[model samples]
Target: MDIVLQQMHYCLTDDASNWLVIAISALLVVLWYERKRIKEAIKQDKTH
Candidate 1:
């Protein structure tokens, strides 16, 4: 019983870490896209 509980705890921790990594990756992608868009807008403003 103790071994089973330990295994379950390990699995939960692993899953949580995987989810955290995915969430951070998604956030970085969004930030990168937004930065690109802002730069384009600034370029257009300067042209006009």
Candidate 2:
């Protein structure tokens, strides 16, 4: 498992690392938006 992790670490060059960070940030943003939207929907449903 350690060897696999080391190989993956070496495979990501500088550009790949930047893209990975961007992709993770975008994913987190989308998840946050979805969670907020769902909470609002549930609140509205409870009111109705």
Candidate 3:
């Protein structure tokens, strides 16, 4: 029982890591948006 629980825990963590990587991969698709956001924030700070 304990071994099965341990295996399940590990599998869940592994799957979670994969999901996190996939989510982060989507950010790469919007590289321009991220750059634009950063540029705008910098411009705003300069104005302030």
TM-score of 3: 0.60
Q: Work out the TM-score per prediction.
A: 0.93, 0.75, 0.60
Error of 2 at 32 (Å): 0.3
- Cα lDDT of all candidates, in order? 1.00, 0.93, 0.94
Off by over 4 Å in 3: 32-48
Per TM-score, the best of the predicted structures is 1
In model 2, state the lDDT of residue 1: 100
Cα shift from native, residue 4, model 2 (Å)? 27
Off by over 4 Å in 2: 1-12
Q: For model 2, which pairs clash? A: none
List candidate 1 stretches off by more than 4 Å: none
By TM-score, how accurate is candidate 2?
Answer: 0.75
Summarize candidate 3's per-residue lDDT along 1-48 as a digit string, tens digits: 999999999999999999999988887768878899999999999999
* Residue range 14-37, candidate 1, lDDT tens digits: 999999999999999999999999
* Backbone clashes in model 3, listed as residue pairs: none
How does candidate 2 score on lDDT? 0.93
Instruction: Report the poorest 10 consecutive residues by lDDT, candidate 3.
Output: 23-32
